[model samples]
Target: MPLILPDQLIDQEVLNQENIFTMSQDQADHQDIRPIKILIVNLMPKKEETELQLLRMLSNSALQMNIDLVRMDSYQATHASQDRLKKFYKTYDQIKDQNFDAMIITGAPVERMDYQDIIYWKELKHIFDFAREHVFSTLFICWSAQAALYHYFGVPKQEVEEKIFGIYQYEKKKEDPILKGFDDSFYAPQSRYTYVKEEDLREIPQIQVLSSREDTGVGLATTLDHRFVFSFGHWEYDKETLHEEYLRDLDKGLATQIPKNYYRQDDPQGDIIMNWRSSGSLFFSNWLNYCVYQETPYQLEKIKGVKVAKFGGSSLASASQFSKVKKIIQAKEDREIIVVSAPGKRSKDDQKVTDLLEKYYEGKKRARDLEVMIESFRKDQAAKRQEAQEALAAVRTRFQEIVRDLDLEEALKEDLDETFQDLDKTQSKDFVLSRGEYLNAKILARALDYDFIDAKDIIRLKSQDQLDYGESYKAIIKTIHKGQRVVVPGFYGANAQGDIRTFKRGGSDYTGSIIASALQSKVYENWTDVSGIMTQDPNLSKDAKRIPSMNYQELTDLIDQGAQVYQRDAIDLVKEKNITLKILNTNAPEEGGTEIKDQEDK
Candidate 1:
């Protein structure tokens, strides 16, 4: 119902004519907010339908946007009236100096001809280049997609012998920032006669295939430094527009199958299914909100390469002016498990972390579900910390009992849980696990007696401010190692490679082991609330026994019964990198914690 300035407008549209962050005229009855300035370069021959279709999509954004329709002068087929073009549209040269935060180039029906052959090809190219340099970001639809890709990235398009007209389904090549907030397997309306094959795009490394059909290839792109994005299919197509084409073609006796894989019944006269419309709108809105708005220069003229020297500095937003959506997450070209997050949750008010992380992976998804897992972890950590604290308190009580009794073997022997049958189950287990040296050593560290140093020097640090590092990122990750008391956020890490990395939810055990392997810790003590790996569930086994020590092989076997295991990742690292791991109760730091040594260490 409202405009949600997708990426493009989200950043650069802030202080310009295209700001979608306001209310529309229909809602004008209530408020006085400035509306977003939106310009559409309607290249379609049927101007009326294209106008209605595009306007419908733009009007639905969460942000407020006003539509300004800009059409090219008659360059090809004849359809729109001369008076309409003259009255409603202005050439790129006419609006060259006027700053727009966002713009769209619709697909025209001219695909059979060469790029240079279209009468307005040169003019259309001007608009294409101008949008990149001037508008924060531009969306080129169908014919425009081919023209712009060829013009901008040198990816050539060829006219296919058969018209690739149909309701084609596309598998996402990989999620891109522009497609943020989209559901998996989104569809776009395609009714074109030409194709831009992936093979043709290989030479230009800047162009990336976002989603492609197996038959037609390359559906969308956000390449050339992401200053330009192109959608080969019409995500903004009016549902009836395609139906109109199908019916029109059938009447003309032009051979056509009922827009393949479309309408539920595949009947030409069946009820039109608009399943793809929802995702299509979501994709476009995200692009405008995130890609364009966040990245466009604050000034407008610099895009045309004109220094603001004439205006005393204020033509376009500075190159640094656009708000950053997210840092680039580069995949390491080496041996290591790569973790990917789900499309991120947006910042509470005016934030786009999903956009940020998409930008992080260079717009290619590595591991899906990372974002949801991180959010879930943050929610659970508080409860975990409280459980740990209660355990620690009981451990101290046990330490005092041990000191007064002076019988380590007797206290350690005789069913440990039976010794504290009077306490609550949780408290009883905490009391039993709390032995002499282990409990007191940790309590010593807690009280700041400083018997040991936390190994933070080996792990990366966090800034309550920006968790991801800037240039200072290098200095922070360069400072981690063993015996150095340091605190690291459990779910995250900063690679020396500049991208901040993270682990699975509750993957602290895994992270600690990896770090230990990297440092080759002589004794990688992984402290937890448990005494050691317990054999049976306490609820299931009234007399469940705790196993003290086991080699990696034996421990991993027992751990495989669906319980969260540590040694899986630890040993993975140990075997690959040759390091050892130890499991200890942080509350009970000594108690000869499970020494999971390899065969050689034993």
Candidate 2:
């Protein structure tokens, strides 16, 4: 292997495991990048396991990342052996002179203990002072969070009668660097019995609460200066780590509570997978990208200063508003994109858009047009069948374990029927899957907190209002470019006479790309769940290295020549403009998303 590993390693294994590292040979060759340097202080019970978990989260970043383990000898948090620490851990004395781009302190089993009583309290205090003055940004997890919080603010830890175990829902506290691109509600794993109380932490004038669980206390917090981030919740933990702990405790005669808000049926015997890992990787990667990679000085700073530094400015404050517009614009700007049916249900238990649209079409009482729509609808129904098949595949093993002795054919038919019935009620695609794009935009516009003008406001742009198609587009573009983002629905037209006429499907992507090209943005950032462009199909490659940057022709070739990554019409919209479309993991924007541009073949 070269300095960087081959971007695609055992491609089949990647797809099989659903790992998001897939990359093409061209991407690998062009992106001759170096690994980011990170320091991890293991304060947990299982040092190496935590090491692998943290490294796994780091692995998803496009950059090469090297991990340095930091060990403290004074505490009873004996996760590592003396030999192992000597062999792999770098002592503070040896590394105090060096600076790191990023640092993570793992959770220790000392939260219930007093600060002065702990054997390593004095040394850990020194680490705290050093973190503020020396390190670029420090991420303190679990016990480290409590220790740092109390040490810096004198906010004390309170013991809990119950261990807060399992997956907990965390509401985003505020728009900050560490919480970028996170949804309103995301999951984090909490497995601690004690935490710093909010009232105590609130006493500190400089504390910034990033997130908090109503019952679990503060989920995450940061110094007002923003240099130190403390996550009371274990967002960096592996999905099943808590489960393992729970099971171990149960086996050891230690009282264990079933992880609350976990295991759908609330059955302790029910099977569960690590859904929280996705959120974990997404959150930490954002921290590394925004706080460490983007903000930290590339040059290392020695521990020469210990003065307190204050960090807040209009620049940081102003970014939150732009981020909303920027991320949506980015999600809009991708080509060769295969849009799934219907936008996701807005809420976990909301009706889909497709069903309501279908019902409305039926209510109009047009036999022939309704027939045509139904045929189109029936095809979507077929697609949903395939989707259900895949969904079933996901829990094939679990299905066997949970629903064993089931009738094979009858169950399959029943599953397919349920999937189709649900599809009928749910709106799958907005522009690509259904006609709900217009409706969705109206809702989304209201949901947003900025300037919005309906397309109807521009009468000339209406289908029957006597405006040219290009003219209406230009007018809408004018509004959007003037910093007023609006949605222009697909499949509609306004004549020179300003008469409205409707068109076919899939024009929204083209409109978005054209608008992006005209605006001369650096790159179109498309937000979606997966990481950027891959070498083989996501189904084809598993450990597909997420491509960093790439050429345009290659992108087209990938889409055109068997890749099916995007639609050509959208690519053609900006081909002349040479606009680059970057596909980002909406879940992990700081993973340095993949960019698509015209390539220079070697």
Please report the candidate that would top lDDT against the real structure: 2
* Reference-based lDDT, each prediction: 0.52, 0.55
User: What tens-digit string does per-residue lDDT give for candidate 1 at 432-514?
Assistant: 22222122222222322223222222234354122322222232223442122332323344434433344433334544454
TM-score of each: 0.46, 0.46
- Go through the candidates in order and give the C-alpha RMSD of each one to the true structure: 24.2, 25.6
How many pairs of residues collide in each model? 56, 45
Candidate 1 global TM-score: 0.46
Instruction: Please list the residue runs of candidate 2 whose C-alpha ends up more than 4 Å from where it truly belongs after superposition.
Output: 1-35, 75-79, 302-602
Candidate 1: which stretches are off by over 4 Å? 1-35, 74-77, 297-602
Q: Residue 203's C-alpha lDDT in candidate 1?
A: 47
